[model samples]
Target: MLSRAARPALRAGAAASSRAAAPAATFATLREIEGRLKSIRNIEKITKTMKIVASTKLNRAQRAMTESRSYGETSNKVYQSAETKPLEGEGKKKLVVVCSSDKGLCGGVHSGLARFIRRRAATEGDNFDLVILGEKAKAQLSRTHAKNIVLNFSGVGKDVPTFTEAQSIVDQIVQLQGDYSEVEILYNKFINATSYEPTIIEGFSEEAFANSPNFAAFEVEEGVLPNLREYTLANSLYWALAEGHACEISARRNAMDNASKNAGEMISKYQILFNRTRQAVITGELVEIITGATASADM
Candidate 1:
Protein backbone atom coordinates (compact mmCIF):
# COMPACT_ATOMS: atom_id res chain seq x y z
CA MET A 1 0.00 0.00 0.00
CA LEU A 2 2.97 2.38 0.61
CA SER A 3 4.99 1.40 -2.52
CA ARG A 4 7.13 4.24 -4.06
CA ALA A 5 5.86 3.45 -7.58
CA ALA A 6 2.20 3.98 -6.57
CA ARG A 7 3.04 7.15 -4.60
CA PRO A 8 4.77 8.86 -7.57
CA ALA A 9 1.93 7.85 -9.93
CA LEU A 10 -0.68 9.27 -7.49
CA ARG A 11 1.26 12.54 -7.14
CA ALA A 12 1.57 13.05 -10.91
CA GLY A 13 -2.15 12.27 -11.52
CA ALA A 14 -3.27 14.72 -8.80
CA ALA A 15 -1.04 17.44 -10.21
CA ALA A 16 -2.29 16.86 -13.75
CA SER A 17 -5.97 17.14 -12.75
CA SER A 18 -5.49 20.28 -10.62
CA ARG A 19 -3.50 21.95 -13.38
CA ALA A 20 -6.04 21.00 -16.04
CA ALA A 21 -8.96 22.42 -14.00
CA ALA A 22 -7.21 25.76 -13.46
CA PRO A 23 -6.46 26.30 -17.14
CA ALA A 24 -9.99 25.26 -18.22
CA ALA A 25 -11.66 27.73 -15.87
CA THR A 26 -9.25 30.49 -16.82
CA PHE A 27 -9.70 29.89 -20.54
CA ALA A 28 -13.52 29.95 -20.18
CA THR A 29 -13.32 33.34 -18.52
CA LEU A 30 -11.05 34.58 -21.26
CA ARG A 31 -13.48 33.48 -23.95
CA GLU A 32 -16.37 35.23 -22.22
CA ILE A 33 -14.44 38.47 -22.02
CA GLU A 34 -13.54 38.25 -25.66
CA GLY A 35 -17.19 37.75 -26.67
CA ARG A 36 -18.27 40.82 -24.70
CA LEU A 37 -15.53 42.90 -26.22
CA LYS A 38 -16.54 41.95 -29.71
CA SER A 39 -20.20 42.81 -29.11
CA ILE A 40 -19.34 46.19 -27.65
CA ARG A 41 -17.08 47.05 -30.56
CA ASN A 42 -19.90 46.27 -33.00
CA ILE A 43 -22.29 48.49 -31.07
CA GLU A 44 -19.78 51.31 -31.16
CA LYS A 45 -19.54 51.10 -34.90
CA ILE A 46 -23.32 51.25 -35.29
CA THR A 47 -23.68 54.28 -33.06
CA LYS A 48 -20.94 56.17 -34.86
CA THR A 49 -22.56 55.48 -38.21
CA MET A 50 -25.89 56.67 -36.93
CA LYS A 51 -24.32 59.87 -35.67
CA ILE A 52 -22.77 60.57 -39.05
CA VAL A 53 -26.05 59.98 -40.90
CA ALA A 54 -27.92 62.29 -38.60
CA SER A 55 -25.28 64.96 -39.09
CA THR A 56 -25.65 64.71 -42.85
CA LYS A 57 -29.43 65.09 -42.63
CA LEU A 58 -29.31 67.96 -40.13
CA ASN A 59 -28.23 70.58 -42.66
CA ARG A 60 -31.04 69.85 -45.10
CA ALA A 61 -33.58 69.81 -42.30
CA GLN A 62 -32.37 73.16 -41.02
CA ARG A 63 -32.57 74.69 -44.49
CA ALA A 64 -36.14 73.48 -44.95
CA MET A 65 -37.00 74.77 -41.48
CA THR A 66 -35.75 78.26 -42.28
CA GLU A 67 -37.68 78.54 -45.54
CA SER A 68 -40.85 77.21 -43.95
CA ARG A 69 -40.58 79.72 -41.10
CA SER A 70 -40.54 82.63 -43.54
CA TYR A 71 -43.35 81.13 -45.55
CA GLY A 72 -45.52 80.67 -42.46
CA GLU A 73 -44.91 84.23 -41.30
CA THR A 74 -45.88 85.64 -44.68
CA SER A 75 -49.09 83.63 -44.73
CA ASN A 76 -50.03 84.74 -41.22
CA LYS A 77 -49.60 88.45 -41.93
CA VAL A 78 -53.25 88.94 -42.84
CA TYR A 79 -54.47 87.44 -39.59
CA GLN A 80 -51.75 89.18 -37.65
CA SER A 81 -52.71 92.55 -39.12
CA ALA A 82 -56.36 91.85 -38.38
CA GLU A 83 -55.50 91.00 -34.74
CA THR A 84 -57.37 87.73 -34.91
CA LYS A 85 -57.46 85.65 -31.75
CA PRO A 86 -58.87 82.24 -30.74
CA LEU A 87 -62.19 82.57 -28.98
CA GLU A 88 -63.82 80.26 -26.40
CA GLY A 89 -67.05 80.38 -28.29
CA GLU A 90 -70.37 79.10 -26.95
CA GLY A 91 -69.20 76.06 -24.92
CA LYS A 92 -67.51 74.29 -27.86
CA LYS A 93 -64.46 72.19 -27.01
CA LYS A 94 -60.96 72.96 -28.35
CA LEU A 95 -58.80 70.61 -30.42
CA VAL A 96 -55.05 70.02 -30.06
CA VAL A 97 -52.76 68.74 -32.82
CA VAL A 98 -49.58 67.20 -31.43
CA CYS A 99 -46.75 67.10 -33.99
CA SER A 100 -44.22 64.31 -33.44
CA SER A 101 -42.24 61.78 -35.44
CA ASP A 102 -42.64 58.02 -35.85
CA LYS A 103 -39.00 57.12 -35.25
CA GLY A 104 -37.04 57.04 -32.01
CA LEU A 105 -33.35 56.88 -30.85
CA CYS A 106 -33.41 60.65 -30.46
CA GLY A 107 -33.48 61.73 -26.82
CA GLY A 108 -36.92 62.70 -25.56
CA VAL A 109 -37.94 64.23 -28.88
CA HIS A 110 -41.26 62.42 -28.83
CA SER A 111 -41.61 62.05 -25.07
CA GLY A 112 -41.22 65.79 -24.56
CA LEU A 113 -44.31 66.45 -26.63
CA ALA A 114 -46.22 63.86 -24.66
CA ARG A 115 -45.05 65.40 -21.39
CA PHE A 116 -46.20 68.83 -22.47
CA ILE A 117 -49.66 67.49 -23.23
CA ARG A 118 -49.86 65.76 -19.86
CA ARG A 119 -48.76 68.92 -18.07
CA ARG A 120 -51.43 70.89 -19.85
CA ALA A 121 -54.05 68.34 -18.90
CA ALA A 122 -53.02 68.48 -15.26
CA THR A 123 -53.08 72.29 -15.06
CA GLU A 124 -55.69 73.31 -17.62
CA GLY A 125 -58.05 70.35 -17.28
CA ASP A 126 -58.59 67.82 -20.06
CA ASN A 127 -61.32 69.54 -22.04
CA PHE A 128 -59.61 69.56 -25.43
CA ASP A 129 -59.62 66.67 -27.91
CA LEU A 130 -56.35 65.37 -29.34
CA VAL A 131 -55.27 64.81 -32.95
CA ILE A 132 -51.86 63.15 -32.82
CA LEU A 133 -49.62 63.31 -35.90
CA GLY A 134 -47.06 60.57 -35.19
CA GLU A 135 -47.21 56.99 -33.95
CA LYS A 136 -44.93 57.82 -31.05
CA ALA A 137 -47.35 60.33 -29.52
CA LYS A 138 -50.29 58.15 -30.35
CA ALA A 139 -48.84 55.27 -28.33
CA GLN A 140 -47.79 57.50 -25.46
CA LEU A 141 -51.16 59.28 -25.19
CA SER A 142 -53.33 56.30 -25.88
CA ARG A 143 -52.36 54.96 -22.47
CA THR A 144 -53.85 57.91 -20.53
CA HIS A 145 -56.06 59.95 -22.84
CA ALA A 146 -57.50 57.23 -25.00
CA LYS A 147 -60.95 58.79 -24.92
CA ASN A 148 -59.72 62.25 -25.87
CA ILE A 149 -58.09 61.22 -29.17
CA VAL A 150 -60.25 62.30 -32.11
CA LEU A 151 -57.89 61.72 -35.03
CA ASN A 152 -54.34 60.53 -35.66
CA PHE A 153 -51.91 60.12 -38.59
CA SER A 154 -49.08 57.63 -38.99
CA GLY A 155 -45.98 57.37 -41.22
CA VAL A 156 -45.10 61.01 -40.62
CA GLY A 157 -41.73 62.60 -39.76
CA LYS A 158 -39.70 60.13 -41.88
CA ASP A 159 -38.23 63.08 -43.82
CA VAL A 160 -38.69 66.81 -44.24
CA PRO A 161 -42.37 67.52 -44.80
CA THR A 162 -43.80 68.88 -48.04
CA PHE A 163 -46.78 71.23 -48.52
CA THR A 164 -48.78 68.41 -50.08
CA GLU A 165 -48.47 66.31 -46.91
CA ALA A 166 -49.66 69.26 -44.81
CA GLN A 167 -52.58 69.82 -47.16
CA SER A 168 -53.54 66.17 -46.98
CA ILE A 169 -53.45 66.23 -43.18
CA VAL A 170 -55.56 69.36 -43.09
CA ASP A 171 -58.09 67.87 -45.49
CA GLN A 172 -58.60 64.91 -43.16
CA ILE A 173 -58.85 67.23 -40.15
CA VAL A 174 -61.48 69.34 -41.87
CA GLN A 175 -63.51 66.22 -42.59
CA LEU A 176 -63.44 65.09 -38.94
CA GLN A 177 -66.80 65.29 -37.22
CA GLY A 178 -66.72 67.90 -34.48
CA ASP A 179 -67.33 71.64 -34.33
CA TYR A 180 -64.25 72.57 -32.35
CA SER A 181 -64.11 76.18 -31.18
CA GLU A 182 -60.37 76.38 -31.85
CA VAL A 183 -57.45 74.25 -32.98
CA GLU A 184 -53.96 74.46 -31.52
CA ILE A 185 -50.83 72.86 -32.95
CA LEU A 186 -48.19 71.70 -30.46
CA TYR A 187 -44.62 70.95 -31.64
CA ASN A 188 -41.00 71.05 -30.60
CA LYS A 189 -39.44 74.42 -31.40
CA PHE A 190 -35.79 74.25 -32.38
CA ILE A 191 -33.85 76.75 -30.31
CA ASN A 192 -30.26 75.77 -31.09
CA ALA A 193 -28.10 72.85 -32.16
CA THR A 194 -28.67 71.04 -28.89
CA SER A 195 -31.85 72.55 -27.52
CA TYR A 196 -35.57 72.31 -28.24
CA GLU A 197 -38.75 73.38 -26.47
CA PRO A 198 -42.41 72.62 -26.71
CA THR A 199 -44.34 75.46 -28.37
CA ILE A 200 -47.93 76.05 -29.48
CA ILE A 201 -49.27 77.70 -32.60
CA GLU A 202 -52.79 79.10 -32.43
CA GLY A 203 -55.22 77.93 -35.11
CA PHE A 204 -58.49 79.82 -35.16
CA SER A 205 -61.83 78.77 -36.49
CA GLU A 206 -63.46 80.76 -39.29
CA GLU A 207 -66.01 82.30 -36.96
CA ALA A 208 -63.30 83.48 -34.58
CA PHE A 209 -61.28 84.97 -37.45
CA ALA A 210 -64.29 86.85 -38.76
CA ASN A 211 -65.54 87.98 -35.35
CA SER A 212 -62.28 89.45 -34.05
CA PRO A 213 -62.73 93.06 -32.97
CA ASN A 214 -60.21 94.33 -35.56
CA PHE A 215 -61.32 92.06 -38.42
CA ALA A 216 -63.47 94.87 -39.82
CA ALA A 217 -60.44 97.15 -40.11
CA PHE A 218 -58.75 95.02 -42.79
CA GLU A 219 -59.41 96.31 -46.33
CA VAL A 220 -62.21 94.36 -47.98
CA GLU A 221 -60.48 91.92 -50.33
CA GLU A 222 -62.85 89.97 -52.56
CA GLY A 223 -62.81 86.13 -52.21
CA VAL A 224 -59.42 86.07 -50.44
CA LEU A 225 -60.70 85.48 -46.91
CA PRO A 226 -62.77 82.49 -48.02
CA ASN A 227 -59.71 80.40 -49.07
CA LEU A 228 -57.40 81.78 -46.38
CA ARG A 229 -58.41 79.18 -43.76
CA GLU A 230 -56.99 76.12 -45.54
CA TYR A 231 -54.00 78.08 -46.75
CA THR A 232 -53.08 79.25 -43.26
CA LEU A 233 -53.60 75.83 -41.70
CA ALA A 234 -51.41 74.10 -44.29
CA ASN A 235 -48.69 76.75 -44.04
CA SER A 236 -48.57 76.51 -40.26
CA LEU A 237 -48.55 72.71 -40.33
CA TYR A 238 -45.72 72.61 -42.87
CA TRP A 239 -43.70 75.02 -40.76
CA ALA A 240 -44.20 72.98 -37.61
CA LEU A 241 -43.25 69.75 -39.36
CA ALA A 242 -40.07 71.21 -40.82
CA GLU A 243 -38.84 72.69 -37.54
CA GLY A 244 -39.73 69.54 -35.62
CA HIS A 245 -37.78 67.43 -38.12
CA ALA A 246 -34.69 69.55 -37.61
CA CYS A 247 -34.96 69.19 -33.87
CA GLU A 248 -35.29 65.42 -34.18
CA ILE A 249 -32.20 65.13 -36.35
CA SER A 250 -30.16 67.28 -34.01
CA ALA A 251 -31.26 65.27 -31.01
CA ARG A 252 -30.52 61.95 -32.72
CA ARG A 253 -27.03 63.05 -33.63
CA ASN A 254 -26.32 64.04 -30.06
CA ALA A 255 -27.77 60.82 -28.71
CA MET A 256 -25.73 58.62 -31.05
CA ASP A 257 -22.57 60.53 -30.27
CA ASN A 258 -23.06 59.93 -26.58
CA ALA A 259 -23.75 56.25 -27.16
CA SER A 260 -20.59 55.85 -29.20
CA LYS A 261 -18.55 57.50 -26.49
CA ASN A 262 -19.99 55.22 -23.86
CA ALA A 263 -19.24 52.18 -26.00
CA GLY A 264 -15.68 53.34 -26.43
CA GLU A 265 -15.26 53.60 -22.68
CA MET A 266 -16.63 50.09 -22.19
CA ILE A 267 -14.34 48.71 -24.89
CA SER A 268 -11.31 50.25 -23.23
CA LYS A 269 -12.25 48.79 -19.88
CA TYR A 270 -12.84 45.30 -21.27
CA GLN A 271 -9.64 45.40 -23.28
CA ILE A 272 -7.68 46.08 -20.13
CA LEU A 273 -9.44 43.22 -18.40
CA PHE A 274 -8.63 40.91 -21.30
CA ASN A 275 -4.97 41.79 -21.21
CA ARG A 276 -4.68 41.22 -17.46
CA THR A 277 -6.52 37.92 -17.65
CA ARG A 278 -4.27 36.69 -20.47
CA GLN A 279 -1.17 37.56 -18.50
CA ALA A 280 -2.46 35.76 -15.43
CA VAL A 281 -3.19 32.68 -17.52
CA ILE A 282 0.36 32.60 -18.83
CA THR A 283 1.84 33.04 -15.37
CA GLY A 284 -0.37 30.26 -13.94
CA GLU A 285 0.79 27.84 -16.68
CA LEU A 286 4.48 28.62 -15.96
CA VAL A 287 3.97 28.15 -12.22
CA GLU A 288 2.31 24.75 -12.79
CA ILE A 289 5.17 23.56 -15.03
CA ILE A 290 7.88 24.67 -12.55
CA THR A 291 6.15 23.06 -9.55
CA GLY A 292 5.65 19.76 -11.47
CA ALA A 293 9.34 19.62 -12.46
CA THR A 294 10.52 20.23 -8.89
CA ALA A 295 8.13 17.59 -7.51
CA SER A 296 9.36 15.01 -10.10
CA ALA A 297 12.97 15.76 -9.29
CA ASP A 298 12.37 15.22 -5.56
CA MET A 299 10.58 11.90 -6.27
Candidate 2:
Protein backbone atom coordinates (compact mmCIF):
# COMPACT_ATOMS: atom_id res chain seq x y z
CA MET A 1 0.00 0.00 0.00
CA LEU A 2 3.02 2.30 0.14
CA SER A 3 3.46 4.96 -2.58
CA ARG A 4 6.77 5.59 -4.40
CA ALA A 5 7.78 8.34 -1.99
CA ALA A 6 6.96 6.15 1.05
CA ARG A 7 8.66 3.06 -0.36
CA PRO A 8 12.17 4.29 0.51
CA ALA A 9 11.05 5.17 4.01
CA LEU A 10 9.41 1.73 4.46
CA ARG A 11 12.52 -0.02 3.19
CA ALA A 12 14.63 2.09 5.54
CA GLY A 13 12.37 1.20 8.48
CA ALA A 14 12.65 -2.52 7.63
CA ALA A 15 16.39 -2.18 7.37
CA ALA A 16 16.43 -0.43 10.72
CA SER A 17 14.32 -3.21 12.19
CA SER A 18 16.74 -5.77 10.81
CA ARG A 19 19.62 -3.72 12.14
CA ALA A 20 17.98 -3.64 15.56
CA ALA A 21 17.54 -7.38 15.38
CA ALA A 22 21.21 -7.78 14.59
CA PRO A 23 22.36 -6.53 17.96
CA ALA A 24 19.81 -8.64 19.79
CA ALA A 25 20.80 -11.70 17.76
CA THR A 26 24.44 -10.95 18.36
CA PHE A 27 23.78 -10.51 22.08
CA ALA A 28 21.81 -13.75 22.30
CA THR A 29 24.48 -15.62 20.41
CA LEU A 30 27.17 -14.04 22.52
CA ARG A 31 25.38 -15.02 25.69
CA GLU A 32 25.12 -18.60 24.55
CA ILE A 33 28.72 -18.65 23.46
CA GLU A 34 29.87 -17.07 26.66
CA GLY A 35 27.86 -19.52 28.69
CA ARG A 36 29.43 -22.41 26.84
CA LEU A 37 32.85 -20.90 27.26
CA LYS A 38 32.28 -20.54 30.96
CA SER A 39 31.14 -24.13 31.20
CA ILE A 40 34.18 -25.26 29.30
CA ARG A 41 36.38 -23.16 31.51
CA ASN A 42 34.85 -24.80 34.53
CA ILE A 43 35.41 -28.18 32.97
CA GLU A 44 38.99 -27.24 32.21
CA LYS A 45 39.48 -26.25 35.78
CA ILE A 46 38.03 -29.49 37.04
CA THR A 47 40.12 -31.51 34.62
CA LYS A 48 43.24 -29.61 35.53
CA THR A 49 42.60 -30.29 39.18
CA MET A 50 41.98 -33.91 38.42
CA LYS A 51 45.16 -34.03 36.39
CA ILE A 52 47.19 -32.70 39.29
CA VAL A 53 45.56 -35.11 41.67
CA ALA A 54 46.20 -37.89 39.23
CA SER A 55 49.80 -36.87 38.92
CA THR A 56 50.34 -37.04 42.64
CA LYS A 57 48.53 -40.34 42.80
CA LEU A 58 50.44 -41.56 39.79
CA ASN A 59 53.75 -40.89 41.45
CA ARG A 60 52.72 -42.93 44.43
CA ALA A 61 51.27 -45.61 42.17
CA GLN A 62 54.40 -45.73 40.04
CA ARG A 63 56.52 -46.18 43.13
CA ALA A 64 54.24 -48.92 44.37
CA MET A 65 54.21 -50.61 40.98
CA THR A 66 58.00 -50.38 40.75
CA GLU A 67 58.46 -51.88 44.17
CA SER A 68 55.98 -54.64 43.43
CA ARG A 69 57.55 -55.41 40.05
CA SER A 70 60.70 -56.59 41.74
CA TYR A 71 58.74 -59.05 43.83
CA GLY A 72 56.82 -60.28 40.80
CA GLU A 73 60.01 -60.68 38.80
CA THR A 74 61.64 -62.52 41.66
CA SER A 75 58.62 -64.74 41.99
CA ASN A 76 58.67 -65.39 38.28
CA LYS A 77 62.32 -66.33 38.42
CA VAL A 78 61.67 -68.61 41.34
CA TYR A 79 58.64 -70.14 39.68
CA GLN A 80 60.68 -70.67 36.52
CA SER A 81 63.37 -72.58 38.44
CA ALA A 82 60.89 -74.80 40.27
CA GLU A 83 59.35 -77.95 38.92
CA THR A 84 55.74 -77.67 37.76
CA LYS A 85 53.21 -79.20 40.07
CA PRO A 86 50.32 -80.96 38.36
CA LEU A 87 46.80 -79.80 39.08
CA GLU A 88 45.45 -82.10 41.76
CA GLY A 89 42.07 -82.44 40.04
CA GLU A 90 39.89 -81.58 37.01
CA GLY A 91 39.58 -77.77 37.50
CA LYS A 92 41.05 -75.94 34.49
CA LYS A 93 39.55 -72.59 33.50
CA LYS A 94 41.15 -69.26 32.52
CA LEU A 95 40.38 -66.32 34.80
CA VAL A 96 40.77 -62.73 33.59
CA VAL A 97 40.89 -59.71 35.91
CA VAL A 98 39.86 -56.39 34.44
CA CYS A 99 40.95 -53.13 36.11
CA SER A 100 39.34 -49.76 35.41
CA SER A 101 38.20 -46.59 37.19
CA ASP A 102 35.01 -46.19 39.16
CA LYS A 103 34.60 -42.60 37.99
CA GLY A 104 34.45 -41.12 34.47
CA LEU A 105 35.22 -37.85 32.63
CA CYS A 106 38.75 -39.03 31.92
CA GLY A 107 38.16 -39.58 28.20
CA GLY A 108 38.62 -43.11 26.82
CA VAL A 109 40.29 -44.67 29.85
CA HIS A 110 37.37 -46.95 30.60
CA SER A 111 36.36 -47.59 27.01
CA GLY A 112 39.87 -48.35 25.81
CA LEU A 113 40.37 -50.99 28.46
CA ALA A 114 36.90 -52.38 27.89
CA ARG A 115 37.49 -52.60 24.14
CA PHE A 116 40.73 -54.44 24.68
CA ILE A 117 39.03 -56.93 26.97
CA ARG A 118 36.13 -57.46 24.57
CA ARG A 119 38.53 -58.10 21.71
CA ARG A 120 40.50 -60.54 23.78
CA ALA A 121 37.34 -62.30 24.87
CA ALA A 122 36.26 -62.73 21.27
CA THR A 123 39.59 -64.22 20.28
CA GLU A 124 40.28 -66.17 23.44
CA GLY A 125 36.99 -68.09 23.31
CA ASP A 126 34.83 -69.57 26.10
CA ASN A 127 37.58 -70.83 28.32
CA PHE A 128 37.94 -67.42 29.96
CA ASP A 129 35.98 -65.86 32.82
CA LEU A 130 36.21 -62.29 34.09
CA VAL A 131 36.69 -60.54 37.45
CA ILE A 132 36.09 -56.82 37.30
CA LEU A 133 37.75 -54.33 39.69
CA GLY A 134 35.89 -51.11 38.96
CA GLU A 135 32.29 -50.09 38.36
CA LYS A 136 33.12 -48.72 34.93
CA ALA A 137 34.63 -52.00 33.86
CA LYS A 138 31.72 -53.90 35.38
CA ALA A 139 29.13 -51.81 33.55
CA GLN A 140 30.95 -52.01 30.24
CA LEU A 141 31.99 -55.67 30.29
CA SER A 142 28.56 -56.64 31.53
CA ARG A 143 27.04 -55.35 28.32
CA THR A 144 28.75 -57.90 26.06
CA HIS A 145 30.33 -60.57 28.22
CA ALA A 146 27.87 -60.77 31.06
CA LYS A 147 27.90 -64.49 30.82
CA ASN A 148 31.65 -64.67 31.06
CA ILE A 149 31.89 -62.37 34.07
CA VAL A 150 32.22 -64.37 37.27
CA LEU A 151 32.74 -61.72 39.96
CA ASN A 152 32.78 -57.95 40.34
CA PHE A 153 34.21 -55.57 43.00
CA SER A 154 33.64 -51.84 42.93
CA GLY A 155 34.56 -48.71 45.03
CA VAL A 156 38.32 -48.76 44.46
CA GLY A 157 39.52 -45.16 44.37
CA LYS A 158 42.79 -43.19 44.81
CA ASP A 159 43.96 -45.11 47.86
CA VAL A 160 46.98 -47.34 47.61
CA PRO A 161 45.50 -50.63 46.44
CA THR A 162 46.15 -52.89 49.40
CA PHE A 163 47.14 -56.55 49.66
CA THR A 164 43.92 -57.16 51.56
CA GLU A 165 41.91 -56.07 48.57
CA ALA A 166 44.11 -58.13 46.31
CA GLN A 167 43.84 -61.11 48.61
CA SER A 168 40.05 -61.01 48.48
CA ILE A 169 40.03 -61.06 44.67
CA VAL A 170 43.04 -63.34 44.32
CA ASP A 171 41.51 -65.94 46.57
CA GLN A 172 38.57 -66.16 44.25
CA ILE A 173 40.86 -66.36 41.21
CA VAL A 174 43.00 -69.00 42.88
CA GLN A 175 39.96 -71.07 43.66
CA LEU A 176 38.77 -70.75 40.07
CA GLN A 177 42.22 -71.50 38.73
CA GLY A 178 42.55 -74.52 40.97
CA ASP A 179 39.70 -75.81 38.87
CA TYR A 180 40.94 -74.08 35.69
CA SER A 181 44.18 -73.52 33.76
CA GLU A 182 45.44 -69.98 34.33
CA VAL A 183 44.78 -66.43 35.63
CA GLU A 184 45.45 -63.09 33.92
CA ILE A 185 44.99 -59.38 34.52
CA LEU A 186 44.04 -56.81 31.88
CA TYR A 187 44.71 -53.15 32.63
CA ASN A 188 46.10 -49.87 31.33
CA LYS A 189 49.80 -49.10 31.59
CA PHE A 190 50.80 -45.46 31.90
CA ILE A 191 53.65 -44.82 29.49
CA ASN A 192 53.94 -41.09 30.13
CA ALA A 193 51.96 -38.00 31.00
CA THR A 194 50.23 -38.09 27.62
CA SER A 195 50.08 -41.77 26.80
CA TYR A 196 48.58 -44.95 28.17
CA GLU A 197 48.40 -48.40 26.66
CA PRO A 198 46.52 -51.58 27.46
CA THR A 199 48.50 -54.47 28.88
CA ILE A 200 47.84 -58.05 29.89
CA ILE A 201 49.74 -59.92 32.59
CA GLU A 202 49.34 -63.65 32.79
CA GLY A 203 50.13 -66.16 35.49
CA PHE A 204 52.46 -69.08 34.91
CA SER A 205 51.20 -71.99 32.89
CA GLU A 206 51.10 -75.54 34.25
CA GLU A 207 54.15 -76.44 32.19
CA ALA A 208 55.98 -73.32 33.37
CA PHE A 209 55.03 -74.24 36.92
CA ALA A 210 56.50 -77.72 36.53
CA ASN A 211 59.64 -76.82 34.58
CA SER A 212 60.74 -73.61 36.38
CA PRO A 213 64.40 -73.89 37.47
CA ASN A 214 64.26 -71.01 39.97
CA PHE A 215 61.60 -72.81 41.99
CA ALA A 216 64.04 -75.70 42.40
CA ALA A 217 66.82 -73.38 43.54
CA PHE A 218 64.80 -72.00 46.47
CA GLU A 219 66.13 -73.40 49.77
CA VAL A 220 63.12 -72.31 51.88
CA GLU A 221 60.95 -74.80 53.69
CA GLU A 222 57.97 -76.08 51.67
CA GLY A 223 55.32 -74.29 53.78
CA VAL A 224 57.47 -71.14 54.15
CA LEU A 225 57.05 -70.41 50.44
CA PRO A 226 53.27 -70.64 50.81
CA ASN A 227 53.26 -67.22 52.48
CA LEU A 228 55.28 -65.93 49.53
CA ARG A 229 52.39 -66.88 47.25
CA GLU A 230 50.29 -64.20 48.98
CA TYR A 231 53.10 -61.70 48.46
CA THR A 232 53.27 -62.52 44.76
CA LEU A 233 49.53 -62.15 44.31
CA ALA A 234 49.51 -58.84 46.16
CA ASN A 235 52.42 -57.55 44.08
CA SER A 236 50.68 -58.30 40.80
CA LEU A 237 47.44 -56.67 41.90
CA TYR A 238 49.32 -53.59 43.17
CA TRP A 239 51.03 -53.19 39.82
CA ALA A 240 47.73 -53.27 37.94
CA LEU A 241 46.18 -50.70 40.28
CA ALA A 242 49.17 -48.38 39.95
CA GLU A 243 49.18 -48.54 36.17
CA GLY A 244 45.43 -47.99 36.00
CA HIS A 245 45.69 -44.90 38.18
CA ALA A 246 48.45 -43.46 36.01
CA CYS A 247 46.42 -44.02 32.86
CA GLU A 248 43.43 -42.26 34.39
CA ILE A 249 45.42 -39.09 35.10
CA SER A 250 46.95 -39.01 31.65
CA ALA A 251 43.56 -39.38 29.98
CA ARG A 252 42.08 -36.59 32.10
CA ARG A 253 44.90 -34.22 31.16
CA ASN A 254 44.38 -34.89 27.47
CA ALA A 255 40.62 -34.45 27.73
CA MET A 256 40.95 -31.12 29.51
CA ASP A 257 43.45 -29.88 26.96
CA ASN A 258 41.02 -30.68 24.15
CA ALA A 259 38.17 -28.96 25.97
CA SER A 260 40.24 -25.81 26.48
CA LYS A 261 41.10 -25.71 22.76
CA ASN A 262 37.47 -26.12 21.76
CA ALA A 263 36.43 -23.31 24.09
CA GLY A 264 38.98 -20.98 22.51
CA GLU A 265 37.63 -21.72 19.04
CA MET A 266 34.04 -21.08 20.10
CA ILE A 267 34.93 -17.77 21.80
CA SER A 268 36.72 -16.62 18.65
CA LYS A 269 33.77 -17.50 16.42
CA TYR A 270 31.30 -15.62 18.61
CA GLN A 271 33.55 -12.56 18.73
CA ILE A 272 33.65 -12.41 14.92
CA LEU A 273 29.87 -12.68 14.74
CA PHE A 274 29.46 -9.85 17.29
CA ASN A 275 31.81 -7.60 15.35
CA ARG A 276 29.98 -8.22 12.08
CA THR A 277 26.61 -7.49 13.72
CA ARG A 278 27.95 -4.28 15.24
CA GLN A 279 29.30 -3.14 11.90
CA ALA A 280 25.95 -3.80 10.21
CA VAL A 281 24.13 -1.68 12.80
CA ILE A 282 26.58 1.22 12.34
CA THR A 283 26.30 1.08 8.54
CA GLY A 284 22.47 1.12 8.77
CA GLU A 285 22.50 4.17 11.04
CA LEU A 286 24.90 6.05 8.79
CA VAL A 287 22.73 5.43 5.72
CA GLU A 288 19.60 6.62 7.59
CA ILE A 289 21.32 9.82 8.78
CA ILE A 290 22.69 10.63 5.33
CA THR A 291 19.32 10.13 3.66
CA GLY A 292 17.58 12.38 6.21
CA ALA A 293 20.21 15.14 5.83
CA THR A 294 19.87 15.22 2.02
CA ALA A 295 16.06 15.48 2.33
CA SER A 296 16.38 18.44 4.75
CA ALA A 297 18.88 20.24 2.49
CA ASP A 298 16.56 19.86 -0.50
CA MET A 299 13.60 21.18 1.54
Give me the candidate number with maximum TM-score.
1
lDDT (Cα, tens digit) per residue for candidate 1, span 20-42: 89899999999999999999999
- TM-score of candidate 2 versus the correct structure, residues matched by position: 0.76
Write model 2 residue lDDT over 1-299, tens digit each, in one string: 76888877776668667767756775676567567657766765765676566666666766766676665566555554574443433446677788886888789888998898778767866667888888998898788989988888888754766657777777765565335555677888877777788887756544435445555566656565546665565567767877787678667667766766776676677667656766775676688679667755754
lDDT of every predicted structure (CA atoms)? 0.90, 0.69
Give TM per candidate.
0.95, 0.76
Q: Candidate 2 overall Cα lDDT vs. reference? A: 0.69
In angstroms, the error of model 2 at 146 is 0.4
Model 1: lDDT of residue 196 = 98
